[model samples]
Target: MTAQTGYQDHKTDRLARLRRVESQVRGVTRMAAEDRQYIDVLTQINAATHTVQEVALGLPDDHT
Candidate 1:
């Protein structure tokens, strides 16, 4: 789901999303380190990538 940032972007919202992505990355890293199945790790990697991309797309286009 795409978020509408408009003029006043919510700091808490952005931080929360970033934190979620960070947690996802950490989990994927741990899974890989523990020699988890390649397919399983790849699935998580794809999920994380999709989440990060979604967050990136939600950012406002205007710099100001």
Candidate 2:
């Protein structure tokens, strides 16, 4: 594929990952609002954190 095509595809993938992270945050918010168990909410928060970190870490590699 062409360079621009590859970049567009990667950008699309990154956007999708970010959207998933957004949904994860929303879920966490809902859980907190509903007074979910502390451990459960904490677990989801950790998951969201990890997902965002993964996306961030991939950014440098994408530039390379």
Candidate 3:
């Protein structure tokens, strides 16, 4: 089989996850602008935090 070129699935998946994290960050910014409920904002922040941590942990040690 011919060797693959360019970005591979492993790298692509990591990038896709990071993109979602970026969206979550943008949502947090919007919440601040709209003066959302304190608890509401915190809840979203907590969810985003876990998403980031999961992505970080999922990456191979050598990559990190």
Candidate 1: tens digits of C-alpha lDDT, residues 24-52: 89998999899999999898888888877
lDDT, model 1: 0.77
**Candidate 3 minimal-lDDT segment of 10 residues:** 3-12
TM-score of each: 0.71, 0.81, 0.73
Best of the two (1, 3) by lDDT: 3
lDDT of each: 0.77, 0.84, 0.80
TM-score between candidate 3 and the true structure: 0.73
Output the lDDT of residue 26, model 2: 97
TM-score of candidate 1 versus the correct structure, residues matched by position? 0.71
Candidate No. with top lDDT = 2
**Per-model RMSD to reference:** 6.7, 3.5, 4.4
For candidate 2, lDDT tens digit of each residue in 1-64?
6445334547877888889889999999999999999999999889888988987888777666
Better of 2 and 3 by lDDT: 2
Per-residue lDDT value at 43 in model 3: 89
Of candidates 2 and 1, the better by TM-score: 2
Model 2 earns a TM-score of 0.81
Candidate 3, residues 1-64, lDDT tens digits: the string is 8976334547777787788889988999999999999999898898889888877777655254
